[model samples]
Target: MQIQVKDISKIYGTGENRVVALNSAAMTIHEGDFISIMGPSGSGKSTLLHIISGLDAPTSGQVLYGDTDIHKGNDKELSAFRRQKMGFIFQQFNLLPVLSARENILMPLLLDKRQPDETYLREMTGFLGIDTRLTHLPHELSGGQQQRVAIARALIAKPAIIFATSQRAILTAKAAAKW
Candidate 1:
C-alpha cells in the first residue's frame, strides 16, 4: 500500500511543558519502497512512524493509505485495516511473557480468525534460526531471540508494508541483514 503523510504535527503537554515532536512533516511512500527515517534521540522519527502507521494520531493533518484517510477510522476499523495491510516491529520487543514464541508469531493470524500456513511458518522460523525456540516463552528467550520472534510475527502475515523502529538494534550484523 502506498502511504501519503500530509503536513502533520504532533504536540504534547500544554503551557510551559509543551513539546513539539513533529511539525508540518510531509512525505509520500510509494509501494515497495524501503524508506528509512534516521535521526538522533529526541527527534521525531518514532512519532512520525507511529502516526503514519495509525498507531498514534497526528495533532493535525492526515495520513492516508492509498485513498483512505486512516486516521479517520474508528478503533475497530483501524485495527482491522492494520492487521490486514501492515506489519510492525517495535523498538521495544513487545512480547507476551506467557505466550510461547510460536503463539506470539501467530497472534496476528489468530486475531483475524485465520490459520497459519505451516510451510511458510516452518520456512520463516528456520530462516530466522528460531525453529527450536518456538515452544519457549518470551521470558525464556534471550534478547536477540525475542527480537527474532518479534520480526517473525511482523512478517508472518506477509503484510504489504512493514513499519519498524530499530529493526537492527538487537540482532547481530549478520542476523539483521537476513531480516
Candidate 2:
C-alpha cells in the first residue's frame, strides 16, 4: 500500500472536556486509487484526512507511507513529506490575496527553493482552465475559479494524497467531482 493507517485514534481536549474524534480507524490506499470518504457531521472524516496527510498527529497508532512511520519522523521531515507527498484542498480556497494565480501556484516550489517547472505548471493551469487568469488575483476570480486555482496549486506539488473537507458537503462533492 502507498498509504497505511493503522489503529489510529484522536482525542481533542482532556478529562471531562475530551472529545473522541477517531477511534481505531484503519485504512490502506494504493497509488492511482480514487477514494471518497463520506459521513455525517463530526464523523472524523476531516480528522482522518489530517492524520493521513501528517498535518495532525494521532493521539495513538501509526500512519505509514510506504514503510516509514509518518508520525515518527521529525518536524522537518514531516514538513518535507507533506510538501512533497501530500496535496490539500480546503473549501475556503486558501490562496494568498496578494499573490497572483501563477504566483500562488508556484508557492510550493518557491518554498522548497526549487524553480517552478514552467511547462508542467502551464500544463496544469491549462488543464484547470486557469491559464488566462494567471495574472489575476484571487478576489478577481469567482468562487469556482478560485477553487480551480486551489486545485492547480495542490496538483503542482505532485502529492501522493489529497485531503479535502467541506462543512456544507456540497462543495466537497463538487470539488471531488471536478477533480
Candidate 3:
C-alpha cells in the first residue's frame, strides 16, 4: 500500500502553551519502500509516523493509504485496520512481561487467531538472529536483544508497513540483511 500525506499538521496544547509538532509535512510512502524519518528530540518524527500510519490523527490535513483516507473511519475500524494491515516497532519494547521471547514474537498471530507458518517462523527467527533467544524472557535479554525480539515480532506478521524509530531501524535492517 502507498501512503500519501498531505499538509499534515499536529498541534499540541492550546492557549498559552501551544506547540506545532508538525506543520504541513508531506511525503509519499511507496510500496516496498524502506523509509526512515530521522530527527533529534521533539522533532515530530514519531508524530509524523503516527499520523501517516493512522495511529495518531493529524489536527488538520489528510493521510491516505492508497485511495482511502486513513482517519475517515471510527476508532474501532481504525483498530481493526491496524491489526490487519499494520505492524509497529516502538522505541520502547512493548513486550508482554509474562510472555517468553517466542510468545512475544507470536503475539500478533495469536491475537488474530492464525497459526503461524512454522517454517516461515523458523526462517524469520533465524534470519533475525533471535532463534537461540526464543525461550528467554524479555527481562532476561539485554536492551539490544529485547529490541531484536520486538523486530522479530513486527516482521513475523508480514504486514504492509512497519514503523520504527531511527535507532531501531538500523538494528532491524542489519538483522534483515543477515540472509
Candidate 4:
C-alpha cells in the first residue's frame, strides 16, 4: 500500500514548555518501498513512525494510506484498522511472559480468528530458525533469539505496512519482507 503524509506536524507540551516534534514533514512510502529513517536523538523519527502507524496522532495534518485517513477514526476503529493493516516491531520485545514462543508468534492470528496456513507457518518458522524453540517462553530465549520471535510474530499476519524500531529486527525484516 502507498502511504502519504501531507503537511504533517507534531507538537508536544504547551505554553512555555511547548515542543515541536515535527513540522510540515511529509513523505510518500510507495508500495513495496524499502526505506530507512535516520536522525539523531529527539529528532522526531519515532514520533513520525508512531503518527504514520496510527499509534499516535500528529498535532496537525494528514496521514493517508491510499485515500483513507488513518487518524480519522476513533480509538477502537483505529485499533482494529491497525490490526488489519499494519505491523510493528518494538525496541523492547513485547512478548507475553505467560505465552510460549509459538503462541506469541501466532497471537495475531489467534486474535483475528484467522486460520494459520500450516505451510506458511512452517516456512516462516524455518526461515527464522525458531522451529525448535517454539515451546520456550520469552525469558528462556537469548536476546537475539527473542528478537527473532518478535519478528516472526510481526510477519505471521503478513501486514501491508510494518513499522520497526530495532536495527537487528529491521535487518531481518528487510530480508524477509517481500511483496
- Model 2, TM vs. native: 0.88
Off by over 4 Å in 1: 167-179
Predicted candidate 3 versus true structure: per-residue lDDT over 72-160, tens digit per residue? 99988887677667888877889999999999998888877889888988998888888999999999999988998998888887888
Residue 15 lDDT, candidate 2, scale 0-100: 93
Please give the distance, in angstroms, between residue 23's alpha carbon in candidate 4 and its true position after superposition: 0.7
Residue runs of model 2 more than 4 Å from their true location after superposition: 169-179
Model 1 TM-score relative to the real fold: 0.85
Residue pairs that clash (backbone atoms under 3 angstroms), model 1: none
**Cα deviation of 127, candidate 3, in Å:** 1.0
Flag clash pairs in model 4: none
| Candidate 3 TM-score versus the reference | 0.83
TM-scores, all models, native as reference = 0.85, 0.88, 0.83, 0.89
Determine which window of 10 residues in candidate 2 has minimal summed lDDT: 163-172
The lDDT for every candidate, in the order shown, is 0.91, 0.88, 0.86, 0.88
Residue range 1-179, candidate 1, lDDT tens digits: 67899999999999999999999999999977999898776899889988988989999999988899999979999998898789989878899888999999999999999989999999999999999999999999999999999999999999889988774445557776897
Clash pairs (backbone) in predicted model 3 = none
Decide which is better by lDDT, 2 or 3: 2
Candidate structures ordered by TM-score, highest first: 4, 2, 1, 3
Model 1 global lDDT (CA atoms, 0 to 1): 0.91
